[model samples]
Structure formats: structure tokens, C-alpha cells
Target: MTKYFLQKTLSQSVSVSGTGVHSGKQTHLTIHPAPENHGIKFRRIDLPGTQDIPALFKRVVDTSLATVLGANGAIVSTIEHLMASFAGLGIDNAMVEVDDYEIPIMDGSAGIFTQSITNAGIMEQTAPKHFLIVKKPIKIVDNDKYVMVYPEPCFKITCKIDFQHPLIGEQELTFDRAKNNFEKDISHARTFGFIKDIELLKKFSLGKGGSLDNAIIIDKDRILNEEGLRYPDEFVRHKLLDSLGDFSLLGMPIQGHIITRKSGHTLNHLFIESFLKNKNAWETGPTKME
Candidate 1:
């Protein structure tokens, strides 16, 4: 048997400090262990007397630049990376406190967060973990981008991306929960963007903290970073990383197969709404280890 069916949380608190990619502001974030069934919730310590924003799809306020969650006039932006780290590690409950409106974009990947939580160690609770088990297919599409889920005994994700750039033309990767390692295989994939888009974001005062050190920047025909790609298909893997975070807002782990094609945060959020509306397509209960 595996621990996937058991609820878990951090054995102790862990913290990280960095700059928010879009806000260009330094922020401190700490993840504290929570009792069973608490789920992941974020509190903006900068705003006193505000309610904690539950890390769930219904609380998502914006997906234009990143997954932003809001409650009681308080907001937490760029949370997908940290949320992905929680989901990837099978962390069932945590209390994340941040000193700003946005979570820091640590190296533009979940590696640091995952490593911190792993070093602190994960504690398993006696309560059973509930999983949303897909019983039928659910899908949503926007233009040429689409996201879909199918019944599966274990969690799996298949991501595909196609860009006109020479360095990253077309790439696809599949991560099987029953077989793959999330930290080694997926956590280090960094967020990427084109040079032109970065310039435009700067014009709008967005992505002000984005740099080669934090994100993989692409020039017209080359990568702007001094170091090259982490993996041959790092681009698609990063897309997969984003998908993992976006879907984590489902409020519980899913036992299903998710396939995404050219999807981003917006499309992923839309698919989550569709999945929730189609409740008959899935059943919720304790998952059995296959």
C-alpha cells in the first residue's frame, strides 16, 4: 500500500523569501502544518482582519497572468507554483501565510518549495484521504487549446505544446503518478516566455521581477539564459507544471488521467469549472492504492 490514501501535512513549518515575478516586490511565505481535512489555505499577513483564501477553484479571482485567489478584499497572486508543490507532494493540509499579495516566484519552478517541504518532512495523519475519482470523461476547449480528463485508477497527466520557435517547436510529456517522480522529473521545469512579451509586460508594469535567473527567457532564435534547458522537453514540462498547479485548486487530489493541449491558466480554470458542474461524471471517496 502507498501513502496516497492517507492525509498528510508538514511535520514542521518551512519558509521561503523571494520576489514576486509580476509585482516586483519581495515577500515572505511560510507553510505551517495543519490538522487533518484543513486543506490548503493562504493568508495575507500584510492585510489584517482579512479572511484566509481557501486554495480552491471557486475562490480563484483572476487567471489573466496567474492564478490569483481572493477573499474579503484580500488577494494572493501567482500562487500556482506553491500550490503545485503542495499537490505534487501529496500534502493534504497546510496554512500558508504570506507577507504580500503575491507568492514569490522562486526560480519560477516548484523545486525550492518541494525541497523545503521534503527537508522538513511530511507527517501522515490518521484520517483517510478523499479523492475525486473520474467515472466519465469531462472536457473543455477554447479555440485550439483544450483540457480533458478520463477515468483512471491513479493520477496522470499528459501535456503537449507547440511553439513556432526553433528551440521549442513541439513537445509532449506524460507523468504517471504510479510510476514517475514529481520532484526529479517535473519540479525543476521553469516558467518561460518570449523576449517580446517580457518587454510588453514591462510596459504594463507586469513581470517586473522576471529575469533570466527566475524564468527561462527566449530570444528570437535562442534562449537568453546563460544555462540551457534542464531537459530536452523543458518547455512542455513547464506547461505540465502549470497544469498541475491550476488543477490542484480542485480542493482534493484527483484519481484520473488529464490530457492538456496548448492550454494555459485561463483554459485550465475554465476546465475546472466544467468539471465541477459535471458532478455526475465523478465520485468522491477514499482512493485505493493500485
Candidate 2:
């Protein structure tokens, strides 16, 4: 198979250590190259004998605060960023080992993971790559929010967010994998939250490790980060970044155009479930590389 159409894994093991955004505890994650067809799986090294958790839609257990995967009573929380990093770079198989239940929220963006993986390099495997090619439009609507996907020759995303806040009223981004660079266009756009919601998140056992250092914090009129926004539309870009990671749970790349409006982890998961159940909407197989 052509290298571009073949599966890929990391060329060497890579590791990162930091604090969990929700747990507020230090955690270490290591990504190791895996054989073809192994797919991306996470092992909780902290809990020996627990079954490995596959990074697929069926494995997701929670999306309240972050995308969480669980199996055999073990879990790995806050995995979207790392999963997005792998998807953005076209990695198909790898073994992710973590010493904590949650993956560290490095800089609150996929930049750290993307850069580390890029620096270590990706290795092409013997097996051909597979893609979930959209055959017909599939849509999921929740009151005013929605997620939809249409047939496209290559992957593309259009995300729109409207918080109705004074600082961030509305933002939109259209990212085509054919032309956009993930690291430059989307990876650096950090996850953001409003100061007003911190207490609510804490009551849910989340956001305990958040700080200006890892995320963009907003007040009524301004962003509290010493350095300002990475892009004027970083909010929308980060939303697109999240959708990219959430969609990766399909267990393969996609050949489609995905559009989202005010979507979040929960909505994304709902859409995935609907998409899977409506099997006629998509087909799985190798796709030609352009």
C-alpha cells in the first residue's frame, strides 16, 4: 500500500507529565508504537489487570466535563486532546499508558501532544488505512444545537459557537484537512471557560486544576490570560478542535464535511450514536488519497 494510504503509529515512545484539569493530580502519559490494526487503546498503568480501554464511541462513559473512556471498572478521563492529536496527525494505532485516570490537560490544548508526536515522528504501518466515508447526510438536533455530516471527498469541519457573552458573542471556523494545518490552525486554540462557571464545575468534581496557565479564563469583560487570544476566532477553532477529537471515536478517519452549531462533548456523543445506528448513512473502507 502507498505510505499515505497505510496505517501509522509513533516511531518512538513519547511521554508527557502534568496535572489533570479535573483531578488536580499529577499524571504521566506515554504513547508507544503499536502493530498494524491494533488501533488506539489506553491502559491504566496505575491499575494492573484492568482491561485496556479502546478509544471508540462504545467505550465512552462520560461527557459531562470531558470525554471519558472506561472498561473493566477503570477509566481514562479527559482524552479528547490526546485523541485529537492522534487523529490530526493520521495516527491509526498506538498503545497509550497513563499512570492516572485522567490525561493531563497540557496547556489546555492539543499543541503539546501534537508537537511531541510530530517531533518523535510517525511510522507508516503495513496495513492500509480505513475511512468512514459518508454516503448520505446525517443530522442530530438538540433544541437549538446540532451536528451534521455530509459526503465529502476529504475531511472538513465547520464549527459555530454563540455564547451571547459580551466578549465572545459569536464565532465560526471552516477547516478543511486538504488545506489546513492542524498544528498551526487549530491545535494552539486553548479550551476556555468563564469565571462565573468555575464554581458550578467544581461542584461536579471538575475544573479543579484550571488556571490561566492552562486555559483561557474569561470574566464579564475580558480574558484573564496574560497573553491574549491565539486567534481572533480561537473560540470557534477550539470548538472545531473538540469536534475533531470527538469524531475520532469512530475508530477511523472520515471522508466527510461535518458542521456543528453550539455543540459540546455530550451533543457530539449523541450525534455519534445516531450516526452509527443509521448505518446506511456511511460505509467503511479504504479511501483514495488526494
Candidate 3:
């Protein structure tokens, strides 16, 4: 049988500071190496008398604006994007220590995390890396929205989003995990939102930490940011990036082809749940490297 259970790796202790999209509060996050099989755990230094939160799908408390995970009365908010970066980089284990409930929305992209992890370097231990590979077609659909995963030897994703705005029309992005360059292709893609949501998000105190520096804000006719789009299809690219991060919450790398359409965190979580429920549809194995 192929070897399974790849050894876990973690970043050398490094810190990242930024503002939270929802809390609008400045936050500090430190990444520290953890022992094998520890997976990814979050510790909130801001709260008192609460236990650490495991970054697991079952603990996910909210997915409306972002993916939030809670456990033992403590919560970690807005984690999908960073978690995706770790997943894409094949980081199997680490401990995240933060001084706030929400992870800092660094540039609203995974580039910062990617850079930090690369700087910290990856260490392969005695154990092997584990992956959940799809064995059969499994699908989840909500009304007209849907996401599906099919058996594959490596991770792959195709995302299609249609905003129909003049600035961002329909766009699609695809990446084969084995062939794609995570840092060059996916890391810099920033999260995006419509101009129409700005007021609503502000009223809810959500975008207090958002700015052109962190996100691509588009009005009805054009992008408000003077910098223009990072890529011609950046809107969908960001969605694919977010999906990668959200899918990473599965607690292991996935070997499969995922197709998503107009889905966000909510649908992402639902898809995870569906996959978990149909455990027979997939099996855990070691990730194959080229």
C-alpha cells in the first residue's frame, strides 16, 4: 500500500499584525510549530478562561460573511483565506496564537501568510501527510447553486462566478494542485465585494478594516480602486482562492476535482458537511508529490 500519514510541519515562530474585517480592531497573530497530528489549533489570547479552538468544520459557527470556528466557548473568525494558504502549501500542522477573536485580514489575501510560511520554511517529520481523496462523485446543491467533487489523484478546483457587473462579469478560474504554483498564481488574489454591499457591510460594522489596500471594491460600472484588477479575471480568481481556504478546513489536504458555482462560505461549509456525511465516497491517503 502507498505510505500514508506524512509527517507534520510548522512555521518557525513568526507574527503578523492587521485589522479584523468585522471587529475593526487591530489584532496580532503568531504562528508556532506544533507536534505531529496536532493539526491546526487557534488560541485566543484576548479572551479569558476559554480553551483553544480547533480549526475543524464541525466547530464552524458562522459562514455568512466568513468562516468562523468556535470551540470551548472561544471563537476564531474570518479564517478561511489564511487556512487556504496553509492548505495550498501542504502545511499539515501548526498552532495559531492570536490576540483577538478574528484573524487579521492581511491584505485580504493569502500572500502574507504564504510569505511568512515560506520564510519559516517547511520541515517534513517522520510521519507522512494524509489526504482525503474522492472515490466517487458526490454533490451538494442548494437551489440553483452547487458544488461537487469527483475522484482524483491530486487536488484541483474550478470556480465560476457571475456578478454581472460592468466591472466584473462572469469569470472562471481553474487550478490543478499538482501543477499550479501556489505562490505565483493564487497567493496574491485578494478578496472582493460589490460597492452595493459597502454601506450594508459598514452598517453591520463589518468592513471597518477593509480598504482598497486589502480588497477590490467594485462599483456598478467600474472598480473604485485606482490600482485596477490584479488579473483580468481576478474576481473569480479570488473566489477560487477563498474556496481553497474554506476547503482546507476539512482538516487535511484533499485529492479531488472540485467544481463550484457562485458559492461562498455557506455553500462551502455545506459541501464539507456533505463530504463528511458521505464518508464512504472518499478515503484518506498520503498526498502524492511530483
Candidate 4:
């Protein structure tokens, strides 16, 4: 198999402004190009002391509702979707500066971030791309919920979600990263939540930025949104989207096929943590295809 790696970036810096999903505080996010090998770093501009949080699975300190990364005493929350956009678009180096702990939910999908990054254009850099290649199948399970990664030439995901709600029964979705169809097939699948869970989330002071605009609201029997689903299997597609973002936290593009069922942020992070811990199962090197 041939390896492939390419450094990439937006043509210029672009900023987006919105309210954080959990904090409910207005925040600004700026995406800028960084030097090669810099990977993706998040800078907390709002903190009294400036600190950088490397978007790595190891730095993940929390994965409740969203993924949170902390380093040098600084934390950045809800970064999975943004990282997914970067990974899906083949962006290798970026500096994500944010003024809050969480990124704006931004319609609860990766479409906006993908569109903005595309508008900025992709510029190639000289450095070779680095990739983590899975050499053996690895699996993690928590009861019936599980995630498994198997050797593949390129990044891919197969996700299945089973919800008891009538609006989203059982659905499965797949993505072939090398085909570059992320924007069309996966990006617009919005986040979703049950009506019964709203009050619970609020009690925990979470989902403050959530609304019909950013998430699909599912009641007992049907969807609460006037407009129907974006895709018949949107729920599963959104799960695949979240998997892409969560896996991107590996700090480099991955080469593997991921199979998941009823997995969420916590399970995704567990898979990554296990991958990192079991180095013998994988190896990283310069791409053979430049």
C-alpha cells in the first residue's frame, strides 16, 4: 500500500462568531494557517494567562456532551466538530484561536466550518504528511455498545445508531475519506437530542446554546422541527460525522476503517486512548504519496 500525506491550510485567516453550546457565552473563533508539523492547536485568548491546548486525544480530560482538551492548565471544550472539518478537508496544519472554553455549535453540523475553510481555499505546504496506520484490528466494547478499528489504506467509517424514538429508529452510514465526499454526505447532518433530555441537560447547566436551529429536536413520537430530516438516515450520518471529529483528535490523519455502534464522544475517546496506549498495533511515518 502507498502512503499519502500533504500539508495544507486555508488561503487566509477567517473568523466565526457565535454562542458556545455549553457556556451560552458569545465567542469568537479564528482559523489561521500554522507552520508544518504544528498540527492543530487551540489557543485560549480569553484566559488571564495565554495557553495553548494541543488537539490530541491524550490531552482530552473530559468527554461529556462534548470533548474537552486541557494542557498547561488551559481548557478548550466542544472541539470535535471543528477538528472533523479540518480532517475531512485534508487540512494538515491550523491554529484555532477561541475566546471561550467551547466552540460555537454552529448549526450543530460541520457544514459551516467546511464551507468556510473551502472559501479560504487550500494551500499546500512542503512538509510530508504524517499518518497513523492501524496494523491490527482493535475493538472496545461497553455492554452492547462498541467501536472497532481495522487496517485500511485510507480513513473510513461505518456507523450504526439505534434510537428508540420513531423519528430515528435504526440507521447506518458510511464514509470513504479518500473520495472526499465529506462535505456532501456528512457535513450537514445536524446534532440531535430528545425533548425529554432538554430539562436534564439544563439542570446540569449544559446545552445552553442548543436550539431547533442547531439540533434536531425529537419528541416522543416525531421530530419537533417543522422541516423534516436532511437525510432519511441523518441520525446515523451525524454519528459518523461525530466519529470523524473525535478520531481526528489523534493529532494526525488516520489510516483505518472504524466500525461503531451506538458510540458517542466518550467511546470515541476511549478508542483513541487505547490506540495510543497500544503503540504496537500501529505505526506512524512519512507518507509515501506526496
Per-residue lDDT for 108-221 in model 3, tens only? 888999899889888877777788888999889988789999987777999988876777778888989768988889888888888779879898777888888889888777
Cα error of candidate 4 at position 138, Å: 0.8
**Candidate 3 clashing pairs?**
5-128, 6-127, 6-128, 6-129, 7-127, 7-128, 84-245
Best by TM-score: 1
RMSD of each: 1.4, 1.4, 1.7, 1.9
Ranking by lDDT: 1, 2, 4, 3
Q: Pick the winner on lDDT between candidates 1 and 4.
A: 1
TM-score of 3: 0.95
TM-score of 2: 0.97
Deviation of model 1 at 167, angstroms: 0.9
Q: What do the candidate models score in CA lDDT, each in turn?
A: 0.93, 0.92, 0.85, 0.87
Q: Residue 3 deviation, candidate 1, in Å?
A: 9.4
Q: In candidate 4, how many Å is residue 199 off?
A: 1.6
Q: Taking the tens digit of each residue's C-alpha lDDT, what string does model 2 give over 1-290?
A: 44448899999999999999999999999999999999999999999999999999999999988999999899999999999899898999999999999899989999999999999999988788999999999999999999999998898989999998988888888989889999899998899999889878888887889888999999989999988999998888888888989999999998999999999999999999999999998999987665
After superposition, candidate 4 runs with Cα above 4 Å error: 1-4
Q: Hey, what RMSD does candidate 4 come out at?
A: 1.9
User: Per-residue lDDT for 66-181 in model 4, tens only?
Assistant: 88899877889888889889988888889998988889888889999999999888898888788888899899999999999999887888999988776777888779877758
Instruction: Give, for candidate 3, the lowest lDDT window spanning 10 residues.
Output: 2-11
